[model samples]
Target: MFASDRLELAERYTELLATEGVVRGLIGPREAPRLWERHVLNSAVLAEAIPDGVSVCDIGTGAGLPGLVLAIARPDLSVTLVEPLLRRTTFLDEVVAELGLAHVTVVRGRAEDLHGKATFDVVTSRAVAPLERLLGWSMPLVAPTGATIAMKGQSIHEEITQARRFLSTWRCGEPEVLVVGADVVDPPTTLVRVPWADPKRIGWPLARDAKRRSGRRDRSSVKREVS
Candidate 1:
């Protein structure tokens, strides 16, 4: 559907939220503000960056923003919403079941313990923590060929730099700021975050490459991944 007009997808997404009630029920408490634009689209924006026919995990997937939405949008991509909070996990499971979304799994656990338990082609995270700390959680859960992406705002440049030390420790790939697509036709919004993880920091250089390309498509990276 993304290959088609994105506006149609946005309309469907609007209806998807209104009828399903996952985003509001899971997030947007009476105390919290700015639910729709901040959390929903922020999470959904990842849908554009994710490759087809891959497995993705959302660490601290509180209400299953990008994770669940992407799952609904791309059935071919297997998605796992990993939320340590029991209430959130229960809410996520119920949402998946009610929505009848396929290839979407709910894993109730933390990133630290998930090591050796399972891995994924990609990992999406937001509101988790700093870049380096997020790396510890995300890197352990991704396949060697996959990468970990954090949804960030404000300080993309500093986060990338701070993530450098941890990237060295994890030997993860490079961290880059990609884009988060919006429903509007405005200049493509940037994911402005990091995509990293791999052995000996092979993903190291990918950080800059992804930044330079702004998450559109990296022929060299894809070619290397195939070889």
Candidate 2:
């Protein structure tokens, strides 16, 4: 499902993950044997849920799991890999440069730090945190009309149930569970898709504050122009 150039890049990425990724403790050596199926392809399959030509931010992108994989599989996307650790971001930056992925940006910061600073059409995470805490960190990064997708394990439904209170408070629509890559990858990949609801109804404090700050900045600019 990838172009020739992208296919080559994916191959190189797999090799890097198996070698340096393991040596650096980014990935366990045991995982190297199944890196293609379990890690690279598993992450790549999530591309099925993402639309073409939209911006995406992958939170806590250690070893670039789904983030770099998505950039390889779908060249149409503009991807930002948000990682907090210096070692992980270092790895990600090198891989992006090596792959010549012009559309990918490696940002060294936690998701919470980006709130009000940036937002995207879609926000993503894999094995980041529990659904409740994940929503707290991810929801604020998604545009009002966007969605947050988490690569979850089999207990996805239970997590959703537990996150119901947070979901209601944040005005998130009902979470949709999806099994992607049914044909290409064995056992498929499970995902939890949470679309954003009306912010006014949900009472999103950060978004409101951001809006007010933006308005103030605009007014200041107008005053400077008048002066």
Candidate 3:
């Protein structure tokens, strides 16, 4: 939930999502009416799972779903919105400026593009990819003690089963499934949090690939860093 002081900002963001968000094809026209309930509030609840004053990176954050929402709700968190599309990043940059969210940073690039270059206390995503693929892109950006917290649907149990091999190969701890915003939202939000099995012994199965990719100069141009 948003604090009283931050409620107005949240409202403004909702309006933008209904207007510019829809016009740019980021949000569906049908979704405009239920933006608050289905999107904003659902995303806001994710704050409950995060710790205070942590650095967060939300990958594939098209139109900044949970990422921008988190920044509005928790001013203490330094949020980085990572998206691959320029159009989406444009809208995100505008929203950050309009809301005067100084702690937010907008990066136009894929999550994999940040591997070996940056890491955050918390890496987040919403319907970006499946569990197995998500682990490949997210784990590289998760700090030794940090975790990847993604919003998932009811098929989470099945997805976890399919990703069992990946969890073990990457030395990830048991995935913790949590339901947040039960009192506020009807069905509530389902989140899957995956952390390293041992902070002292983090695994980087793709570190070599990340380093090779990071060496490419072209990749740098694709990632736009806007504060």
Cα lDDT of model 3 by residue, 52-120, tens digit: 988788999999989999999999987888888889999998999999998787888788778876667
What are the candidates' C-alpha RMSDs?
9.0, 6.1, 4.3
Report the lDDT tens digits of candidate 2 across residue range 1-227.
56787899999999999999998999999999999988888999999999888878899999998999998999888787888788888899899898898878777878887776656778999999999999999887777767899899999999999999999887898899999999889899999999877745545665434432112243233223322
**lDDT score of residue 20 within candidate 2:** 91
Pick out the ten consecutive residues of candidate 3 with the lowest summed lDDT.
Answer: 207-216
Clashes of 2: 0
- Measured against the true structure, the TM-scores of the candidates, in listed sequence, are 0.71, 0.89, 0.91
Weakest ten-residue segment in model 1 by summed lDDT: 211-220
- Give the runs in model 3 whose Cα sits over 4 Å from its true position: 205-227
Query: Could you tell me the TM-score of candidate 2?
Result: 0.89
> Per-residue lDDT of 91-198 in model 1, one digit per residue for the tens?
677767766665667767676655544556788887677777777677666665667776776676787787677766646555667755756323334554334443
Best by lDDT: 3
What's the residue-level lDDT of 62 in candidate 3? Answer: 95
Off by over 4 Å in 2: 199-202, 208-227
In Å, residue 137's CA in model 1 sits off its true spot by 0.4
On TM-score, the stronger of 1 and 2 is 2
